[model samples]
Each structure stands twice: as structure tokens, then as C-alpha cells.
Target: MKKLILVLVLVMGVFFSGNAQKVPTSEEIAKKNIEEMDKRLKLTPTQRSVIYNYAFDMAKEQLLLYKKQVAGTAKEEDETRIYRLQNEMNKNIKLVLKPDQIDEFNKLNEERLSGIDPGKKKKKKKKGEEEEKVVGIEGLKSTGNN
Candidate 1:
């Protein structure tokens, strides 16, 4: 029947659309970031592993705090949580990096933040607009031009 066919199409569309919009886990994001940093900083495998573990733990903690902040938490509470997270992150960096590397990391973070276009707000794109894959070291190598 026509009604049955219509319902089937609608259900299929919904299923496929949901599958297309999958968000990466915090661990995935942290690993991707660490991998990129390894490439950029020329970090050794041991350094990369340590940094990745630290970042992953930090991201997990921060993500929970962020969720709380989004759900009607006070600004002061959010700020305190973020400050604590920063301290923890700093401590982790100290454990894994030399003082000079820590300084370099701070500067790199500042530069990256500054380079973002302030006027352009990020918005969810329409389904058809292909998502830009986050480029890691392999991606750069594949492109053959940095």
C-alpha cells in the first residue's frame, strides 16, 4: 500500500540521518589533538603517549564540568571548575614536559585561539555540506603540501 511505503521511507530516512550525525567521544577528540600536537611538536612516541593520556583524562573531567555549566550552573561555579581543571592540566604538563616545552605549549595555545576568526560564529551545517575532517599528521602527509 502507498501508506506502508511512505512510512518505510520516513523511518529509513530518520535512521540514516541519525547515523550521519554521529559525534566523536571525548577520548577520540583528545587522541586526535595529541596526534596533531605530536606531528607539530615532533614529540617522541613516549612523550606522545604520556601527553595523550593526560589530555584524555583532562578532557573527560572538563567535559563533565562543561555539562554541568550548561545545565544552569552559576558562572562562579563554572569559573571555579574551569580553574581547577586548568591547574590539573598544568600539573599534567609539568609531569610530561620540560619547563621550556610548557612555555611553548602555552604560547601555541594562545596563538591558536587568536587565529580563529572572531566574527564568524560556528553553526551546525545542513546535512549535505560535507564535514571537514580534522587533519592529523597522516592527513598532512597525504596532502603532500603543508
Candidate 2:
């Protein structure tokens, strides 16, 4: 009986631990974001450094907002701030890029915004259930009808 209980406890602990996701740190977020941009834009070392700073700042702000949302303390202003941060980051990134790079950056932004297909309806969740949260930069925008 004791061995059975020990085995059961170990199995339960492993199952719960496996289910828990570790949230990425702001630096991890920034590094991943910059890596994507580098692949698309072929950014120079200097440009990468500057853009990393912007992405890091944006990620930090987003993490704070996420915490508030999880705590059910998110305010309307948080959404507005997210949009503002995205715009600011885009503008700053553009400043660091060449004219050709700027065009590519703009194209990337357009793709990000338009990636969602409007024709498909979202699956309805049961009452009291929350909508699925989008992750990454795209998560800044609401997935519902605008």
C-alpha cells in the first residue's frame, strides 16, 4: 500500500509539473523577436542591437500587462498602451533600417496585422470561459471582430 501511494504521488507530481508552462523572460522574448526580424530583414549588428533594445522594452511592458490580466486587474488603458508601444517600436525600428529595409519592415507589419482570416468565425466558448489569448506581437491585437 505504501509503495502504491508513493508511486501515485510521483506520477501526479510529474503530470502537474509537465502541464505547467514556464513563461519566457523579457530577454528571451526580445532575443526571439530580434532573431525573426534578423532573418527577414538581414539586419546589421548595430541595427540588431538597437532593435533588440526596443523589443526588450516592449516585452517587459507586455509581461507586466499580462500579469495584471491574470490577476483580473487589467484596465482599458492597458490595451491602448499596448497599441502605443507597438507603434513606437515600429517607428524606432524604421529609424534604424535603410530605405529598402524600411519597406520590408512595413511589409512585415502589414502581414502581422492581416494574418488573421476574417471569413472564418471563431469557435464559441461556454459561458464564463475566456477567449484564447494570442501570444507574440500579434497578441497585442484582439482576435475578435474589430
Candidate 3:
């Protein structure tokens, strides 16, 4: 019993410690996002600076909106905010990036907005038969008698 208790405590400590690590700050998030874009786009120094500021501002705004639970409470407003941010970022990007870079950036944004990763391929299902669709909670209710 003593050995079991000791092992359980140690296991719990490791689990909690992993979850207790500090969250990255907005600056950290912005730096990482900018670094990724710079790598893919080969950004000029001027473009890098502009994108860094835009990324930093966006990270801070997203953090604030998340903290406010705006997504849960106001779905339309949250979406509108995100769309505006995207537009502003794109406007800034167009001014600094080359024409070819703009096309690449647009493609990257399209992939992100669509939630599709180009590197991973999902297998296609058979086309011969359609799957059954459940209607409402009726399908989930317990049918067994007490």
C-alpha cells in the first residue's frame, strides 16, 4: 500500500507539472508566426518589420477576444473581427510583398481558412453506397425498458 501510494503521488506530480508550464506571451506567438511566413516567403527586411508588427497586434487582439469568451458569446461578432483582421493583414502584406509573394501568401491563407493541410492526404471512401444519417436526438435515446 505504501509503495502504491508513493508511485501514484509521483505520477500525479509529473502530470500536473507538465500542464503547469507558463503560456507563451503574444510576442512569442507573433515571433513564431512571422518566422514561419518569412521562411516560406523570403521576406525583405522592410516586409519582415511590417509583418512582425501586424502579427504582434493580431496575437494580442486574439488573446483579448479569447479571454473575453467572445467566440462563445458572440459568434458573428467574433467572425467579423477575424475577417477584419485578415483584410488588414492582407492589405499590409500586399504593399510590402512582391507580386509573386502576394500570390503565395494568398494561397497560404486560403489553405488555412479551409483547414486543409496540403501535405496530408485523406483517403476517399467508396462511392457505391451512402451512409445512414441520424436525425435529431431520437437516434441517441435509450430504447431499453427499465
What tens-digit string does per-residue lDDT give for candidate 1 at 6-53? 332333344445655663456875787686666556676788888888
Candidate lDDT (C-alpha), each: 0.57, 0.70, 0.63
What TM-score goes with each of the models? Answer: 0.53, 0.65, 0.60
Models ranked on lDDT:
2, 3, 1
Please give me the total number of clashing residue pairs in predicted model 2: 0
For residues 1-146, what per-residue lDDT tens digits would candidate 2 score against the true structure?
22322332233334335655776678987897788789889999999999999989987887776677668998878857776777778878898999999998877665445543233577889999987767775665344534
Which residue runs of candidate 3 sit more than 4 Å off their true CA positions? 1-21, 70-79, 117-146
Clashing pairs in 2: none
Which pairs clash in the backbone of model 1?
none
Q: Which candidate tops lDDT?
A: 2
lDDT of 3 by residue, 31-109 (tens): 9778878877899998899999998887776556544552356455764675577567778878889999988887766
- In model 1, the worst 10-residue window by lDDT is 1-10
